[model samples]
Target: MPRFTVFMGLLAMTDDFVILVVDDNANNRFALRVLLSRLPETEVIEAAAGEEALMHTVTRDIHLILLDIQMPGMDGFETARHLLMTERTRNIPIIFLTAVFKAKEFIERGFAIGAVDYLTKPLEDNLLLSRVRFYQVLHARENRLADVVRQLRRQERSLSIALSQAEAANRTKSIFLANMSHELRTPLNAIIGFSEVVARSATIGPEDRKNLEIIYRSGNHLLALINEILDFSKIEAGRVEVVDEATDLGLLLDEVIKLLLPRAEQAGLTLLAQVETIPAVVRVDATKLRQVLLNLLGNAIKFTRQGSVVLEVRGDPATEGAVRIEFAVRDTGIGIALADQRRIFEPFTQIVTHAIGAGTGLGLAITQRYLSMMGAELTVESTLGEGSVFRFTLVAQLATEAVEVPASKGAVIGLAEADRGKRILIVDDDPDARRLLVQILAPLGFALAEAVDGMDAIARTASFCPQLILMDWRMPELDGLAAMQQIRAEQGEKAPPILMCTANVLGEQRSEAIAAGSSGFLVKPVRRDELFAALEEQLGLCFQRESTEQQKAAAVVISPTDLVAEIATLSDEIRDALRKAAEELNTSEVGALLARVADDHPHLARHIAAMLEEFQFEELIALLHA
Candidate 1:
């Protein structure tokens, strides 16, 4: 019996495949099973009649059915008719087992009922196995095709759902942006308007004047946060571009450091930059790369209160064709928890939310998107209390050949003395932003003027006869782009260097502005140095490099006594540090240092406990004297 079973299994393996044997004869069923078992993959299922075969075909995954022409109740012809009419089992291949011989009419009748092939009374075993194997292969292919069709249908449904969800999310985001614009601009207008009125007032006391300065600075910082959000949105939508060009990486790094150094200092934290190596020349999108570096360094300095925020660079040999540089910002501040590390990079996700106050929280998200576009990746390694290190590699196209040294020097061209009395028109709907620009330029001896809207700006231009017009995008009645176009139309080629002073720093917006007759762009809360530099460049000023010390000294210098008075006026963390330092010393140099510290790390508060241990009475007093 065991040997017989082994022989049957071997025969089954040789020609085994699924075959439905349907007949009223028990002998016929047994014979068909034995015959099919001789072939490989042959799994013969028995059905006593046509009705039983049709039922089995519907219930199980039978590939082929051989039906007897004459059964007791439901004959082969009627079963085939039923199977063909039903959708589920219509595609099952069928073969007819008949005693009838040579009538074309009977053959045509079987073909009409979906019989693919037929056989006579005495079955040929070789012919039977051969036909069964042929149908088996065809059936397997159909099964696979059916599965593929099902998968495609499922994928189509999934994509439809996803697309709908994305559209809804986009609508919500659009509404959120509109609401935020109004909420932010309203307070910003008052802060800017009141500060301007006080700053320019000749009758205001020095103390009152100092108070106004604080209001102006805070407002400006808040404005920067709002603008960052707008730019980030544009970037995520793929509307931002890298504008690839030869960039001065060192100068870019220095500027970013200069902007954030004051904040780091205010927190009693050192800001350290280490350039172990830098590519002498590499092609990059200077503006976008600056945004990336600024966001990374800014976050590092904001989080690191006591320890230094270190920026380190290294060369990557793999990216030899285009110089690959590795940049990392390491900080020992309140490091992100392991669980929150991934979330930290997401938009609007601030780890120490209360500590790092008043940001739109889009900086890191923008940086990530920017890096991705450049075919790079950013990763962070952190421990909850230890610190975090954010590192990314950038491949900037290397200059094919060496360029002139003068071009590489990043020299800042000073405006000729003629700029002093030149009339300027500032067109911005944001009153605070306009005020900031006026204050920065007015000191440089320009006859500054402003317009609240684009229409007013065009009207002001005719009489003002401004040498330069700093236009803001996203204004009511006429936006910066439309206004610039109108201005260019009226003035033709003589549209005096219309520069766009906008928070919409997205590349498309920049190109649109330039196409509309803007000579260049300056991103906002316009840095004083960049603002002047844009003016000089647009006004065709000759280039001149200033000594670093002279540049630092020339910046609006606030004395320690004056700064302490300013610090004494505030209610923030930095202000509290100054008050503590003031009680310890007779003078307010501690207040000045606090003021300086506030300039750098406005979000940080000095640990009074640490201060007690670090300073002696005279040592602390000397800081006040400085």
Candidate 2:
């Protein structure tokens, strides 16, 4: 009997296919081996008994097995049962070949015992070859498929390892950025804070006041740059969120123009603002909007050497209560090339031809992202060697309530009599930072204590029992979070309100500090007013502000005649040096020159100082010549 009849074309065989021949007589085994050898790359193993066949199946990688129905000790049927019982040789295909057991019941039993085919004593060679070839090709295909599966598993493992490494590297980069921001902002806290403190002194002459103003403004500019970098980092981390509030668009625009006017004047460029019409108050993210305008106007001033930079704003009614405001910043400078226009919006990208001044190249990129977050797109128009206009429109609902002009929190002279004796503990590792807090609070008549680090602050908290604590985030002895946790655990609800004043400006860092029981979070270079507001909130204290009359008296300007007379009193050499310093716009040199005049002619120096404070350089120069 034969199972496979149709003969396809002769197929090529691989060397991997191995066949086992099991029989009672050696002659039958030899005949099967000869027939299997006809196939290319096929290996045949001869087993005289079923026992030998089982041993071969275990030791060798057998693909196909030929079994005899009866043997002396272990027959083919019993051997097949044993093979099926073991896990190792269960999948090997078996064929039953028998001479005596050719009866119908015996054949049926052979087929039922897991034999792939039951052949009679007189075997057909062609049919046997076709069947053997079929199994050989099938086994070869299985082996190839198995090889592919193994290769795929190896590739998957490699990708998993690579992905893990990439994630680890990104984490490292984020940590490095956090540390860098903290380190940079810590010292800036003192720089900006101390400048403001000194500038507020009533006794300081107008010349000294002007110099301090420069220091304060420059510190703020540097702080803004630091913030820009941090903002980009936040954008990359997908943590930036827009915080909308009622904003006086007109007032904000005025303030931005005033801030950047000095730069434009220095560059001999005109800065103009044209507002056709706009809502008095609109709901929007004031901080981001201000930043966008600053970046655009600043870049315009930097690039244009002689021409004017214009900030034109137009508004139109959109929906029932919303206004679509189109703000455009146009400059007369070297414009961006058509090829580089789109590239300019990419982070840290600078056009070669338009790189006229110092910048991080992040201004426009940040501006674009900020606009995108506000549901707007920043578009640009430019002509090479002419100028460029960057414009964007935002739709904001009109805030119906009148924008309240907050009364100036004029120079905080001192705390009210009730809060004068309240105890305050300042905790920081940096001496300057502690000194800054002392400078701000000690003058207000608060009983202040200073601690070097978190551990020292915890000790002071018990001994001094301060009413309020200003804690720094990073310290040598113990980190702020861990130390704050310990204090909260020990003191529980009795703990004094602890404000975490740190240089870590990240939103997540602030969240962590608050989660650890911080009363409030303050990012540094903390403004004096901001620090005072935070204290007032925590301590429920009122501050004594400078009176209206005192503020007015401090702001009074010197008469032109008095200024001219003061300039005349200076020595010929001093007058020339003063004129030269004012002409060069060297603020420090002018301040030094004014000190010389203050020594002998105090009244005249004060008058000339007023002129310097107002940036009346041309007037001062003419008075010097007179």
Candidate 3:
């Protein structure tokens, strides 16, 4: 509601009181004025009729109204009712003066019309003076009360305006922080992505490779700091979101350890993790839980210079598959002082230690905040000389399905690489991000197309018809959400899978991309393997970067007898359908046939898809005969 100002008209007076005397007869008005003047410090306002009396109330301050009962146009009773109706004149006491109406009924009627007192024609001058004085005293009290009320309302309106401005400023700050997150993360993604690609180059010399590794690590650390700021802002604003799904907790721990192992080794710290003997699969927010563990483990490893950093997970199972799991990280480096434990959790609070890595102090604070949202807390125990231990517990329900954790990719023996020239689109406003994506995918023998922003992505998508798209979430003209919606609406079935990449890993953004029909959402800086994994999953591309074109050509060649012998392990019924589909050149049906055992036999799926795309029906003889 908008603020409102109300001007109230109540009887106001100084030491000298002003009275309104209304009468049609000039003689009666004179008599009432002369009689009212008997009261000390008094001034009489004369009105010939009720309308004139109302005008006097509006123009001048009238303490009390002395209305004559016998009037030509508006009588005294009617005039008293009018005086009681208006806010300006309502609070003024009315005294009716008349020679008649002394009967019980007329006297009651006079008081019923809001008259404070009534007097007959032969009124005593002394009594009239005392009544007017009593009314003036009562009017003074009402004015004082109304003054206080008006003051309170003014203060209330001021507070309301200030509160509105504060809320608006907070909203503006939130928008700035959100935009700042996007602006910083866009280029940070490119830096981390490109540095990692260079670090993994086999052709680089030892010294150069070492420098590249340093660059890669530094970029990653920078990305982490940026993430910490964004996360802290979200948490502070109460916008943190948690998404729960079925995940293998054991594998999650292993991946975190794998990620930190290199850094731990570089620092000469022994890093190890152990998952207790319990059910591996559980329903939880795997992303948040992994983040918590990563922070704790990374901190433990970073702070431990010469000694070991160990991560341990233990599950205390209960009835109905409910388990209380405790995750702890222990280190043997320089321990924190007891007084500093609390301060270290505050943002930007750096511990004085001999460790090399300098981290944004938000890691522990964010971890604790995340845990608190999940109904948990972080507990720490540290001595002055020895290392420290940090732990937390979470409740989870065990998953019924057996978890099939993927083993390491291992050596690519006999892994036939897919045909080259698979077109992939990279969409971002930042040129560095686009160039970095090209660097990551070009060596894998894929054709690359670039779009500057969301608007550019929409314009080029239909014609380029890329098999995959890595779209940045924040863009200038059109954001990822709007562009994705438009592309899906226009292209429908032909729109290629879009994997949105953003620096923000908030669940709301993830949910938005999913709602907009995005195929995947990846937070930057994206890892090289994870990026390829998404491509392989979405496009069914077999990644064997070392496989030459000469080898792929030789593998698809066919001979009638040799082909039948090659797939002798195949069943008869599936064999007939494969040959029929290959003959009719139904690529989708061929893909469906290949899907039957693709999970178990990715090599055969890649082989069959390749032959089907090449239209080499002779090669299908072996697939059919299998």
TM-score of each: 0.59, 0.66, 0.59
lDDT (C-alpha) at residue 240 in model 1:
68
lDDT of each: 0.71, 0.82, 0.76
Instruction: Estimate, for each residue in 1-626, the C-alpha lDDT of model 2 and write its tens digit.
Output: 23232221112233668888888788887888888788998888888887888877766678899888878999888999999999988888988887774368768887787778777777899989998899988988998999999999999899899978867876776788789888889888888899988886789996588788877877887887788887887787677899988999999999899888755654445688999789899999999999999999998876664467999999996578899999999998778889999798998887764325445678899999999999999999999879999999999988877778777667788877877889999999999999988988888899999999878988999899999999999999797777788888889889899999999888889999998899999998887778889998999998999988888886644434444555666678998998899789787898888787677877566555655654656545655666
Candidate achieving higher lDDT, 1 or 2 = 2
Error of 2 at 572 (Å): 26
Clashing pairs in 2: none
